[model samples]
Target: MAAVRDSSFERQAPEADAEELARRHLVQPWPYAGSIGSEARGLIGSGDGIYVTDGEGRRLIDGPAGMWCVNAGHRREELAGVMYEQAMRLSYNTPWYTMNEPSAVLAERIAAHAPGDLSHVFFTTGGSSAVESALRFMQFYNNVRGWPEKKLLLSRGGAYHGSTYLSASLNGRPRDRDWMDVADGLVVKLSSPDPFRRPEGMTVEAFADQLVDEFAETVARIGADKIGAFVGEPVQASGGVIVPPPGYLPRIREICRDNDILYVSDEVVTGFGRLGEIFASQDVFGIDPDIITFAKGVTSGYFPLGGMLVSERLLADLRRSNHPDAMYAHGLTYTSHPVGCAVALANLDLLEGGILDHARAVAPYFQERLKTLEELPLVGEVRGVGLMACVECVADRESNDPLKLDYEVGKRIDAHCHSLGLLVRPLIHMCVMSPPLIISRSQIDDMVAILREGISRTMDDLATEGVWQG
Candidate 1:
């Protein structure tokens, strides 16, 4: 490999360790591995505000918010110190038959802070359990309503709820369903309410109308009387952070109401200040879901914790049904784990302070920086809200079609950024971003600078391979 004129090179050996591990041990790692993001090595450490230090002393700004879960950033001493205190005193207690102080306190905080009739909180170890609990509640609600036939659930076209069987099926992703068949029955996919992907000459209103029509068709096919629930993210994070068009959420709310389906918001990623709102569903979209799944920011990712917000009607039905006595048959061993709850409470206190408001205030500035990516060569679309953002890479600007570089091109760009000390997470063909809410203007510029360099070189590198065309 002598010097090739004007040819930018990308090192492949760096991610070989990750590939080997995947080939030898793991089976599924969606939006993280495979041809998309496997080249970057996995890390074991992080810091406050805007950086993650790998075990090997590699540092990069985590723009994707720790799988879009960590809104409060990592390595916050408050979250850590509180957890230590809790671990010293009453670290574990069963939420099932027994309760703990921290868990009760955290539940009160969640209920008070949560929107709408979401006054009841059921803690889970993580987002997966929260989503699973939401699904179970759908069936239970239908049974309680005396309509067991309404078992079908509808989800958005590309939302990522979780990875467990029920949650995966509830999600709207092709990659997630590649191996697992829909054995769970009645999980229907509907067109998402994305403004960017709207059909030609269609207004956001019309596109949303089409989306509602698709849901109506699904319900018709399944019979509205048989539909149980409709679940989706307010911003559709895992699906390239496709922010739904204006009036889209209200329309979906209408559709759910028209058909009498429970509306579930998978806010596992958009909850907290990620969207500059407490919950994207209510603050951004102006619609409140019957139930919402939450994790990541709830505990600031200090300890694994996710929970489901329940409405009054649902809670009353459950209480009236004697569901606890009947054993609804759901819960994790670490459900309402005391340490996680304590950290969550501490994290909540930290988030509730003016820091969240500061993040919200500067959201427009962060969004402006993200939009600057449009001037780059390979970058096509920049979608974001609050601190969350995404840049969809494309080979040609005219059609907005993907380069189909798959893993190779994405890894090269990501590695190039890493080498420059900026960390970015590539999801599918799009680069996702969710830097900690505490990120400053300078760090945002730093992150964007590296990304610009990486994207600029990707075109040059791909051209050398004769794969990219105008």
Candidate 2:
């Protein structure tokens, strides 16, 4: 009977059992290879504005803006038409020597919106490649232009740059590096700006000082001559929504400048109005990075196009030194992918047109709604800006001790919200929210209401199970 049931299950397939086996057995588990862990997770068939419809017909709100990429909502018809037209017109092109019109247009618009003299644009296939491109350029800039001995890159302890060999090495979180089991020897990690888990009474200002001193000491230990660049996500996304101190970025920028190292800002999550600014660094921190890598919102995750906005310094060095014979030796095969570029251009137009204004106007209201969660017994901290926010859970108020043994608290909250049709993600000890820029007050209220219910239900479940006697 068991063998017969197994045979029937195996016979069922969407395309075919062979195709299902191909994904489940042969493939490296799609984008995140280890997420599903020896099997497939949930399958999504389609998504509307702020909700995703799964293969099983379950509708869930997209809480993390599609992994913090889709600034615009899903199922955008205009973007769809643009992609279709772009595919029909010019499908592919070599952006190296022969540039295409879509790429040129997108570049011009991006440069204009990007902060400061971040004027030159270099294309990559996605965020990982974009970050990798920036890191490699840092090395190349040091070797070709000056300071070949400077090859070490410094990043915060909880940064999530990307997943490529070089980029992931730059990430500071233990989770991202957990299974990897080794550092690539070119990166350095320092204290993050998070005060939640740091030393007691540590003011945000003190945290900034600590970060600078930590970097300075690391530079001294490595002998600054071996350091090429100091890279960071200005608003620390995957590192538990860690926001820098009031003067954090400026202080870090100063430290990097003092040591004669390039400063690279990984704006994959903070760029394109996520922080209510085109670029979070220049707008909020008053710092000028040598290079800026951006993705996600560049195309709203519509077609996987990302790029770095290079400064005049690097561009000039590349132009003067990179002769016809010189390799310059970088670039993905899909660099400036034509169809992707067109979709990105359309995405940008929507962002600048009205979506950005909406995000800015409603951000404070959203912040207010999030702050309302502080009344919940489980919520220890609610911190965020613009459209990105987080609710940290704790068992105690003073120590901020997390309910780590069982995600029952966080899981209950997640499941309750999921059951209510609101999607939420539990990262370590927090519930992170990064809704699309197009979200309305009503949608925001609905999400917050579900969150309130989720917290209450989680507490009730915990109390019922003898985990929370209070």
Candidate 3:
């Protein structure tokens, strides 16, 4: 393979024709299939640092870090070089019966950064697979231990585990499951631990106590023997970066431990420096989960790699039990691919070198700057920690009443931001931003300036178009 140094994408034809070609060939993810060609979402041609060049030769700041995975930024020669070398040496290998050096090395490095006794690793192709594998492993563990009744999962409302069947069943996002059929009765959901969305007039501390008490009551009602695992994101990402009350995670961990339920942390969006650490469950949140599913930033979007970290105590129990002969019987064809692992290793070097520290030092500034948006009448709340944040738009801030569903407010904000040379990830009525961990303070200012202007323009549009009566 040869390297292409060209930055701008060469136009094959007019922009309209190019977009039409995309709609014809590409089936966008999480999309309304009927509206494939109705809108023009620019094609990303090339990326460098925190910027991506669109198909029409326009450069824009990457606000969501390529779906919250590109933590080390784009076009990193070191990662590219590692991938090229590993592919040339050993592009493919069957992990079913054989193991590779890169995978072993990467797993060791990951375990080193992981918390507590999470000493074992199982790699997957991406976040979804990682989550699927963890759930399967939990089921297998229960089955082997003669507790087949422990098959139900306990996840919170507004959590997103993955898109696979079992994992998707654990997803609590209303829209995500509205049209799809999930494995019924497999999961019992608790209320989301969103402080911003707490019952009106309830204090944050009281809200946290209520959330924990709810979990305790749910366990008592369902019987802990019927539950296999309690899965949750430290900070719910796709459900809109909902940060919980301070003591929420630790209290949940205690309850799970008391009830003999596996506590699984879904770090698909928060791992690998997104939260200024390799893993945030223990270091930042003060609890050691029995299982941790991670993806996205492992290779910094240079390669597809995700994994599940297993605690030593759980494996010890499995080894000592009568199920010593039991087999987990789970893996993927691309599990531990050498190229992905090699790229991940290089990405880790970048993170551990200095980027993690930079993120920690700059996160407060980022949060502080975005909080100013709350002054805008169209903005309801600003909530986040570390590099990730969400700005939710509302029609009434006093009541947090959202705009009408058909208003497409988030899309309008995204469009305006794109015009101003910034790319933001829109989740219905909210804008999500998790820029590259390498982004500078000055770059953050530019990104926030564009976001503010975009929101302002959106407010004007909504008023002019009669979408906002006030």
Candidate 4:
């Protein structure tokens, strides 16, 4: 493992002038329209293992795992090679009338790992398309079943579904929909299962029961025949990594079944070894979703690909029911792209080889290490499962009073962590960590120590500004 100089891929020392070109060209997501040049993170040059080096050659531990998709880590030569080989042989074949080998094989492999009778797959370009396809399939299934009135989609508050119009409408996060025009009557919102934000004097178990009751009551009020599907993220990743209580998912599944509603599990951020499993719905939560949407880690971020696993029973009913010759009539140009599927197949080999087991073994240690940060005065709560975690900062520790929006506590912590050799996800006042699943125990220790120091620095800054009394 000794470092060796390589002439083939020599680094071009980054010039400070690069910012000028970026400012005039690049359009970043979720930022002030005109601030990309001044506010964007500097150019990332390269990555290896669990670390990424920026243009200035600052090698930092990738705590957010490249937006929680690089489960196997960066610079995976096997995945890269697969994409290259597939491109060389056959890159694109319109999936409308024609088909490809890699696509069929990848679908079979995915169905084998999915829960229950989920034996079919519908490919998409990414997480947003996966979600959009699942919703459309639900509508199609109900329409073919003579329940065309069932068009309502139920979603929970604080859920992050996707960016497409239909999928984005299902997103219940306030900030996600504040300025955008969401499909008004298409979605019904429910409260999030955030224990930290639960009503006062309510026990966790009671809160769980209350949530299920509310769901049942809502179904009764809205009439089951009018509901199409209920979509949810098992862990609510982008909503500050909010983990629901035990038994919550199963209960929701039961309610969906009773009401003849399709249960859609959005596993875009939780699948493919991130939660110590191939897919968390069945293995970890003990529930079988009618349709499970997945993306991101399918190819470990090496390719753009995602899809939905459909239950055989549902497809069978649709095939046998009315409108038997009707077409679902929905597909993307890149549907079942040969190159993406080939890369995904190779990525699966790495996960099954040993990376999944490594993640399972190291998860407990990761969770325990993060919990220690709760002792800091600025940290109000530290919660997570597996490799994903969140540290919420507040001004009043006892009452959990969150800081003002302008404070940008999480961004401050992220800035310090970046300087100290780590990069964590910043969500307003909370910092999230979901490191590459292959990160070692020693490297995890380093990550946590840097986060601790980052928070310490932020606390000092806040004290100087007199915004928080520690």
Candidate 5:
């Protein structure tokens, strides 16, 4: 395939000067103290389809799909056109007292795709705020019901909710909270349902049973009356794309329902065709959550927008509450922005048109292709569902223990893959691959081929450096 370029995105400054400026001025997310404001990442010049050209003019596959949000692919004219037209018609509207037509329409459209009675939407700036809104709403709901003490949240070991205070508190990745402080008293963590890390010699079904029992035991010990909600990713996106064992989510949902604890599915990564569905709660997992927080692919990352879909039953309960005059008291300045909603509408059209069908048809092949990487000695496992997957490296095949070198293995693989024309999201010892849903079978082959070579080269480097032998 020929390289596609967008002249409109031409760099204003030379590559060397641009890097220098960024190192001096820009503060990137997840910065380390050693290089906090003095670092510059690879410069991506422009993107089209599943490919992006870096500042060095190397065309590479967008392996992580712009942090797993660019589902409709890069440089989509439909999404771009809608944003421009919407901005021209009505760019900014304060959603506090007033509202806009696009938000209402988008909400209605989203509600149609949502499960159960999730008929209402509360827009936010992004995934972090979306989750923040859901958690805060849970607090307000309990308070309004005269149970202010019932505010403890339940999260899992391998989850990634968001970056806001409360939401970040729920993050379960190893390093996410090492240097950060969270509301420790307000959250309860459960075991990660990662079948890969399940106890040795245990069947997957037994592992699932163990997980469910743990939840039940935790609830019984802590008293369900004190719990407000249980938030989890259907697939645990950043947690190495951890797909729980079969029948786990439905059982957990039932437990949440029986205990009157709300189940909040954070679909920031799984929603919008990444899992071959608009919402994976009911359609894919056979569970209807009380609230579903989503962002990322809603507008294909064209604009920053996210929101939570609330069940009608929850809203009705609030309506019937004695505190009829109570206010939830949560809102963002950019809540229900007209342009974001309009872009989302167009993005929905693209998905419903045929992109969703394409994603569904190609997902199995995508998974199968990536799974082949497990043949490599460095790969401990390659597991995922739909188009999302993870390649986890281990020190040895027997124990599946990670390299003591921390995330260096993943970074080395990413470095090699970047040179081989593919971008990769290195999450510590794992390399996550959630390419754009628009990727073709040929593209998947290319991606996996490059990845295999990258990992092989990384193994070679490790052996040369006396890190490990296979």
Candidate 6:
């Protein structure tokens, strides 16, 4: 006998109709001014493991892993079950006056895994809020300490913190601030630590020295007394997976410590086993930050949850401050949502069960396989740490001029890959690949194979159209 379909389920509209409805009503993120309110992205029907079925029933590998989350993969029964159970037991609770058990338990677990004296957690709704909270806390801490003038934030080029007003002001990508407005007076920019983009003939070590020198010089020129915090991602994710030079992060941490500036590690993409560790600041980079902001992978994208771990030293200082009545005046309605925390706890169990170790075991292979793509003429460089990598296409490899290449190269490659059964996250002239941590070796091979062919086809198309010669 065949399995029976549930008749009680509500009927759904056709895929094309759904897409049309979205085009008429939805306003997607990162939209252009011309198409801001009328854009319909490709519709995804469902997902299982590292694969998602598209609207037309094509099974494509989730290369970007749902915006660098979904560490445990898709259709996770454990995560889904816990969300249902928690919602049924206690769906919603006001965190302003009350408390929840799961949030407390999750905080304790996270603190145990955190580095240094980071023993406190402040939960938020997502990554942007987590970053916003950290920055606000920095300001509040300074104010309570009677250093109101120390309000400037230091951010490097290629950095991406969040979308909130204060946090978005710290973004340094060229296009991020072109047409948008931010609190410009609050931020000071620094050079990006991209080794591949270093000055011609500069050694990676020398480039590292220049970056550190620039930071020290900037602090000296601007005076550390006026600076509040320096926020950075462990690995620049959206800026094309720019893994900084050796000793770069630790040296920066030391400078922050010496100057009394808060070092905010925006581990929104690197935390929760993206780099084969619970947190990469201390374990991988040998630095203890004043605060660590995290999101994306915390709950494996099973739910919207993000937070930060503040150092015990900072809290102790705040407690010992003269103003005992001053409030932080920061929080969200879903500060400690029980259902989200429950899903996070279950996701944590899944990671510790073996997925993290699996990522560690296969990271070397992942990097090595991706590096092979550099042999392609259109490929300029492929760089990343752990499971995250970027494939940068360039028109002239000798000069490494990505600007000379067609800006739509990444999108073209993505379109071809989508047809060949792989979804890619195109970032201008680069394509980012960060498959689920649970992806197998065979799946990695399949992903790389499809990417290789897609890129080759893109090259062929460009050549035929007289865009660029191979």
- Model-by-model lDDT, in order? 0.78, 0.81, 0.91, 0.90, 0.94, 0.93
Which pairs, if any, clash in model 2? none
lDDT of 1 by residue, 1-470 (tens): 12213324353333456557655655555444445433333644546566887656787888776777667777776777787788877878776789888888888887786778988888998888899999998887777666889888887787888877888887676777776776457677777666777776878778877887777777777788988888888888878878887787887888888778899988888887787766777877888788988998888677899989988877787677734564466788998899999888887887788668878887888889889989877788898887888898887677677766554466777778877887778765688878888888888888888888888777788778788763
Candidate 3 or 1, higher TM-score: 3
Q: Which candidate has the highest lDDT of all? A: 5
Question: Model 2: which ten-residue window has the lowest total lDDT?
Answer: 1-10
Arranged by TM-score with the best first, the candidates are 6, 5, 4, 3, 2, 1
Task: Give the runs in model 5 whose Cα sits over 4 Å from its true position.
Answer: 1-11
Model 1 bad stretches (over 4 Å): 1-40, 320-325, 405-408
Instruction: For model 4, give the 10-residue run with minimal summed lDDT.
Output: 1-10
What is the number of backbone collisions in each predicted candidate, taken in the order shown?
3, 0, 0, 0, 0, 0
Residues 264-288, model 4: lDDT tens digits: 9999999999999989999988999
**How well does candidate 3 score on lDDT at residue 9?**
42
RMSD of each: 7.8, 6.3, 2.2, 2.7, 2.6, 2.4
Cα lDDT tens digits for candidate 2, 377-440? 7788998888999998888877888776455466668778888877787785678899888889
| lDDT (C-alpha) at residue 239 in model 1 | 86
In model 2, state the lDDT of residue 288.
89
Model 3 off-target regions past 4 Å? 1-18, 36-40, 405-407
